[model samples]
Target: MFYFDATYVLLIPAILLSFWAQAKISSAFNNYSEVRSINGYTGADAARKLLDANGLYDVPIEVIPGKLTDHYDPANRVLRLSEEVYYGSSVASIGVAAHETGHAFQHKQHYVPLEIRNSIVPAVNLSSNASWILFFIGMIFSIPFLARIGVVLFAAVVVFHLITLPVEFNASSRALKLLESRGILYGDEVKGARKVLSAAALTYVAAALMAISQLIRLIIISRDRD
Candidate 1:
């Protein structure tokens, strides 16, 4: 039977941090969503401007459904922004738009970390889904070999999460600098943009922590089965 003990105890901090990060991002996004940019540029406009500034005129921007679902698809060379971020002229919208643009910039410049992250996308996706299934199966059957395999697979997920940190941080950093340098946000408006980006960054940090903690628990459980 599965029981909670020291293995679970080690995960408490990461779990708490994940909750806090979620709350922080939600609050920051909501707050900044209401604060309009001084220049009255919609999120799409901001993204286009950034892309044009970077000489990526062919990169198309599309409006997609869902909240906070903005992303840059390097494969398709397109930027997909959610409704709020696609049409809204608020500081939060612009910040989110710019952050995705940063990814495009990274792709254009061949940012090593982003390249590495993208290269492992397939492996990460496969492992992330399979790891839990393998782990639970091993737990149910008390199979040490299966559990070890599960742990190894899950370790890839942890590595993906860790590598994701630099990619995300660099994107946010690029967004902030581009926003200020390009005169998209002025004075205190930059601070608002920074706050939004910073809060979003915390979510990535939380994810890394949670993944690491889970991996540790898995390692402990695998050892105990021996």
Candidate 2:
């Protein structure tokens, strides 16, 4: 019955877009990953160069397992890079690495959106876990008030997704600019990095759309029960 729900009409396009975005990122990353940067600097090296240039000597780069699992941990002030991006000298690798480093820069500079997103993380986690439980239980028991609460809570997820768009775009923009200005990647190599980052950005856009669509579905379902 859940799978057969009528509201899925609102979800299908976002779902399809999510699939397409994933495919685009995979293809773009894999393709550009093969094209080595002219300077032959590994992803780790690029990250180190950026951090050092910014006088962030305390932030260490760690080797994290899995492909494309790279991220910046603000709490510990560390850069965690996936195996491919950590050791790779390819354009995609450095681009991804630089992107993560960009987060550290944002953290140091106190970017407002990043700060707000971090602050809301606890509530978002609670809302994500409990929203569905409340919605389903309310629907089962015919309690419209509880169902309305669920929809409101679910809206938090959409807000989080919306906030993520600017954070992601800013990081990618910083990465590309730093890569070019510092000569980490040059000429057509920067183009490859841009392609990779652009494809990656689409995934966030797709996620935001999916979150919005899901929120709409929840609202419609809640209202129908009223």
Q: For residues 1-226, could you state the per-residue lDDT of candidate 1 as single tens digits? A: 6645668887889889889998998999999999999999999999999999999999999999999999999999999999999999999999999999999999999999999999999999999888888887888898877778889999999999999999999999999999999999988888998999999999999999989999989888878877
Worst-scoring 10-residue span by lDDT in model 1: 1-10
Q: Which stretches of candidate 1 lie over 4 Å from their true place?
A: 3-6
Q: Which candidate achieves the best TM-score against the true structure?
A: 2
Tell me the TM-score of model 2.
Answer: 0.98
* Candidate 2 wrongly placed segments (more than 4 Å): 1-3
Flag clash pairs in model 1. Answer: none
- Each candidate structure's TM-score, on Cα atoms with residue i matched to residue i, is 0.96, 0.98
